[model samples]
Target: MKKEYAVIGLGRFGGSICKALSEEGLEVMAMDMNEDRVNEYAKIASHAVIGDSTDESVLKNLGIRNFDHVIVAIGENIQASILTTIMLKELGVKMVTVKAQNDYHEKVLNKIGADRIVHPERDMGRRIAHKIISNNVLDYLELSDEYSLIEIVANSRLAGHSLLDLDIRARYGINIVAIKRGKEVIVSPLADEMIQKEDILIVIGAVADIGRFEKREMQNDY
Candidate 1:
């Protein structure tokens, strides 16, 4: 059976999610208070409705509880987002995800039983900033406030060493999650797998340790 998802907002974030879900062949219920926005997505989604997501009666009437997951993506209005998330949880939706505009919004969503909180704008900004600052840093994803997954090029110092010789975890307190060699990716690279010049190492560790590895060790390589 196709997974059913309900997106309760018609803003860019919510609309993009609805479109992506539909493209992925999932059944999506796209809801919005604006009639025009709902009609626009009605063509793309399995069902699109004009409704006030913050209203409990409207949610109940839509049978939102039957959805596998509900995403509250209302932008600007933290009140509506929080209320909708709470109502959805009370309506017995299996999972609820919310797009938070800020830290306070995220905290409130968490307290209201939102299963997941996404900070799309903030996360993207951080990723762009990191890429701008370090030419060698290809990508970055924050796993937690203190930990992250990073991608950095294998510089000269690491060109010929095997995973066993590097011992990243023991030496730098990081793990090489994967290695990208040109177009190919080797996940969980084995100890015998050798590193090559320009290989992009996908690493995961505490943010501070990754900074150390990039600045002190990798940058100084000849």
Candidate 2:
């Protein structure tokens, strides 16, 4: 069965999601307060409506509760975002994801029962900053405040060393979850598998440990 998604706020964030969801054949209802924005997404999404999402009556009329997942993507207008999220939960929406402007807004949304909170700007900024700072860091993702999943180029010195030889888990307290070589990806690599220079290691560990490993491993190469 095709899933249904509702995206409130026709800003870049919400508009992009609606377009992608519709392109993938999911049922998407794009809602925004601006008629122009609603019209822009009309052809992209399954349905598009211009209405104030903070209004419970409008939401009820639109059957917002029927959507499998609702995304509150309102920008800067934290009040409207909070109100819409509260109304959606009150209407018994199964799942609600809100785009938060800050940590305080996220805390408030969570307390009001938002199922998920997204910090798009902050996340993107972090990823970009990491790329700028390190030439060997291909990508970075935060799994939690304390831990992260990072993709780093295999150090030349560490090349040809097998997982068993390094014993990363016991030695560095980090896990080599995956190895991406060119187009190929190896998940849960074997203990005897050697690290090739072509390999991009997907490691998960505490932020500090990962930083230490990067410095110790890639310092000379960079």
Best by lDDT: 2
TM-score of 1: 0.91
lDDT of 2 by residue, 95-142 (tens): 999999999999999899999999989998988877776678889999
Local accuracy by lDDT, each model: 0.90, 0.91
Compose the digit string of candidate 1's lDDT tens values, residues 1-222: 878999999899999999999999999999999999999999999999999988889998999999999988998988888888888999899899899999998888888899999999999898887777667788899999999998888887888999999887898899998999989999989999999999999999998998888777665767
**C-alpha RMSD between model 2 and the true structure:** 1.5
Q: After superposition, how far is residue 107 of candidate 2 from its true place, in Å?
A: 1.1
Model 1 gets an lDDT of 0.90
Over the full model, what C-alpha lDDT does candidate 2 score relative to the true structure? 0.91
Q: What pairs collide in candidate 2? A: none
